[model samples]
Target: MSNTGAVMQKTLLGWIISGAIADKVVSTSCNLSIDQGLDLKLSKFWDIEEVTSSQNNYTAEEKACEKHFIENYRRNEDGRFIVKLPLKENRQLSLGNSRDLAVKRFYALERKLCQQPTLKTQYTEFINEYVELGHMQRIHETKLHNADTNKSFYFPHHAVIKERGNCANSPP
Candidate 1:
């Protein structure tokens, strides 16, 4: 497999594990069946730690999402956020599609985050960084295409640190 494929697989796995952890559905015996040949078990506490670490290995936009989640939300004892369902025309629906419910929950969280004054600057900075990273990635991909190279480029960790430094030096 190419490096890009490996990176994408790792990213998808990280999202799966993070979502499971957040939903408090992570179990002591975790089984993953990707294909007929790939059956894996994640056991013990260390396995959870490994998955958490992988989730932290993210792009600028992803890091922003993680920051937003951590700062604006609190998990219950079960490690899941208590999200109330939206009322539909003064009546509560007993059943709803999971995907639609998830989208509503996400939008609710985003609205809560937007209400915070202290987080406003942070969120703006996050958006700026995310846009910058997107532009940089597109440029890099174009360069690679012109050079006829199949290599994929990820943002350097040092660039993140450098951006932090610039933010610190600048006035808000």
Candidate 2:
């Protein structure tokens, strides 16, 4: 699932570069400055290129990330890959609980849904199907008071609706 892509990206970089040889051919890459947002947009850097090819340089943090990945990644019989969350040797996530933000965002979504019935319907159906398929499960009330609150991962989600193409109004 794309949900695991972040972890996969960090892990796979180690594997991809392990046996790589420096290219003898002269080549260049674009040194792009992109906004810190995730979206399904093409890399718009190709049009602008830098004369150098040393863009493969990895930062010290990235090197540590790759090393952590190499040592912790594994695959099971179900073909799902797993790895321990990569934290610096003596570091932990210095963050607060996200439940408040999640609640706020959910209410915002609910407001949006109230204004767009069709979208709301589509989103409801999609979420119902997802739950039915067991991709997600409702957290039991008893476990909501988990002692290790910081270890909980909160994922944000939304439905993408198509308004054009032969796909019609249906979600692709």
Candidate 3:
């Protein structure tokens, strides 16, 4: 069935109408249990499943993420959300070494910012405000390694100040 048996183009009365037979998304039926079995399967593209159950479909790790978010997230003094990143297990971070990539991207961003002084100012102010709001913290470059793993990791970040949905090249 997965490899694509005969595809059903449409249903005529109670019988399925057969069409092409290849690896594709199409409604099909077969009698697996019995020779006259009547079970129809309609592909929702990319073999994606529909959420039909009343209960949540969270995996253990996903449930753990939700639990972490629920337990740790809080409101700031101004009643704004001070949300923590939902991670799995005992607050463990498995970020790999990304200092090189981060530094490269940082230089690229710096170059772009230098070209636009007003944007640079706005971005700087935004980052400063983020730090002031306790949403972010300034860390020394010398102490950038994770204590447990002893690997340098960097969190990737970008800003999206939207007048409309464009990108970094445009003046957002």
Candidate 4:
């Protein structure tokens, strides 16, 4: 199962880049910094390093990021969790807003992922795309509606995707 773990890690890495982790992270840190004067600058640059550097080191901030990242990616809808990526600075684009940056990053990533030829790559890319809004759950719902025709993927409710079956039932 080592290979599976490796693949999972790689997939998670892609999701991280797809603004899943970073969006939550940057937003969370900014808020914390603002609320507690926690030196968000240092937190921004240091927190990732701290978590990545040592498996043993676990600060409250670091733990918060880890928890927040997972929850936000699942589209938990925490008000504080949603950091609107900024787009304007002094009337013009600030180039610092996360939402704007995420949009740009996602577009670039989409282009790159589209070029790949493998199912794994395609699935990863698809998941990455949905990460921002928890599309995984929706896909599961769609799968259920068309289960007879499409039997390849099992739509797990726990998946980040939303389930739409409750909206209306289909006839056999």
lDDT for position 142 in model 2:
77
Candidate 4 lDDT tens digits, 103-162 = 466566566556754633655766688786775454455654554432243322212323
TM-score of 2: 0.41
Per-candidate TM-scores read: 0.20, 0.41, 0.41, 0.18
Candidate 4 Cα misplacement greater than 4 A, ranges: 1-96, 119-172
For candidate 2, the 10 contiguous residues with the lowest summed lDDT are 6-15
Best by lDDT: 2
- What value of lDDT does candidate 2 attain over all alpha carbons? 0.66
Candidate 3 lDDT for residue 56: 78
lDDT of 2 at 115: 95
Query: What lDDT, from 0 to 1, does candidate 3 have?
Result: 0.66
Residue-wise lDDT of candidate 2 within 1-172, one digit each (tens)? 1222212122311212223334553873434344443221323343345367543798888878888898999999999989999866767874567766776777888999999999999999988998999999988767766636686755555557766555656555
Provide the lDDT at 41 for model 2.
32
User: Relative to the true structure, how large is the alpha-carbon lDDT of every model?
Assistant: 0.48, 0.66, 0.66, 0.46
Backbone clashes per model, in order?
0, 0, 0, 14
Q: List the residue pairs that clash in candidate 1.
A: none
What ranking emerges by lDDT with the best candidate at the front?
A: 2, 3, 1, 4
